[model samples]
Target: MFEAVIWDFGGVLTSSPFEAFARFEAERGLPADIIRRTNTVNHLENAWAKFERAEVDIETFDRLFAQESLALGAEVRGKDILPLLAGDLRPEMVEALRRIRAKFKTGCITNNLPANAIGSAGGRTLYIAEVMALFDHVIESAKIGLRKPDSKIYRMMVDALSVDPAACIYLDDLGVNLKPAREMGMTTIKVVSARQALAELEAATGLSLR
Candidate 1:
């Protein structure tokens, strides 16, 4: 029923950054969800959102995030954790991308940092290059001055793909990002696991990844 498949990169295609954050937290004796809390401190207006929108450079994000962490009683620096966020990729998601590319238009809607140039999202250039080759169109927030869960970026994806929102199936690990797609009439899949997501995709699109 869908003409296109839309995906989120970090938590969906690659292993979740939250996993790394939890590990880092465990190793450091810090509070759980501290990193996410720091990023979500101001919600959409947080430094992470600003960084994704390309409003602030990496150095600025590091300083801003460090300050946010300090406000929460953690002295962690954003720079120290940035390099470790390149999560190991899921081969299944890559396979699903290729499998669906043959029949349906595929796009990647990711909230990524500017290229490894500014030290934000450090060590991500090669991985981004690898994934970019797989998509028909890549909507990266850093390049376009927009980010997901904003609803407008989702519209931007629709315009770029030239597809009706109703004819697209959107997938993201975060419920917040998926909510707008559902409101826009696209079928939304909360990607809790690759097996669960691919099963839903097979059932919805009849493109079997198994």
Candidate 2:
């Protein structure tokens, strides 16, 4: 029933940045999940959201995020979180994408910062570029000024892919991002772990993902 498979780049294709966030928080002696809390507090218009949409520059985001976190009882600099966003790639997930791409149209939608945002850009950029090349089409929030959980972005992908929502299968680590696709008639899979997500995709696509 599905003609296309859509993926979210960050948490789905790679190890989650949230794991890095927790480690940062623990090392800093701040409250657990504080970074997540700050990001979620004013989700749509917050510093993190603005950065992803390219509405704010790195310095501006750093100041704004620090202020936002201070208000929530911790003063974490935004620049500190930038390095944490570059998670190690999951080999199995990358292999799965290669297999799936041979049979179905594949697309990636990611909410990301500018290329220069990362502290060490050389290796990271090359690795990400390699993975990104596997997709037939890729949409980035920083490049497009639209982030996920916005139904418009989801519509944009289906429109770009030239596929109806009902004929697409979407995978995202965030339930908030998946909800709109699911509502629009796409089969949605919420990725918790690589193993679990692959199993779910296997059932949905009737392919041996693992």
lDDT for model 2 comes to 0.92
lDDT, candidate 1, 1-210, per-residue tens: 689999999878888888888999999999888898897778688878898888997788888888888898786776777866777788898888888999999988998888763343555566657777888888899998988888998998889899999999999999989999999999999999889989999999987786
Write candidate 2's Cα lDDT for 83-181 as tens digits: 999888898999999989988999999998976897655587678789999998899999999999889998998888899999999999999899999
Q: Assess each prediction's global lDDT (C-alpha) against the native.
A: 0.86, 0.92
Per-candidate RMSD, Å: 2.3, 1.0
CA lDDT for candidate 1: 0.86
TM-score of each: 0.92, 0.97
**What is the TM-score of candidate 2?**
0.97
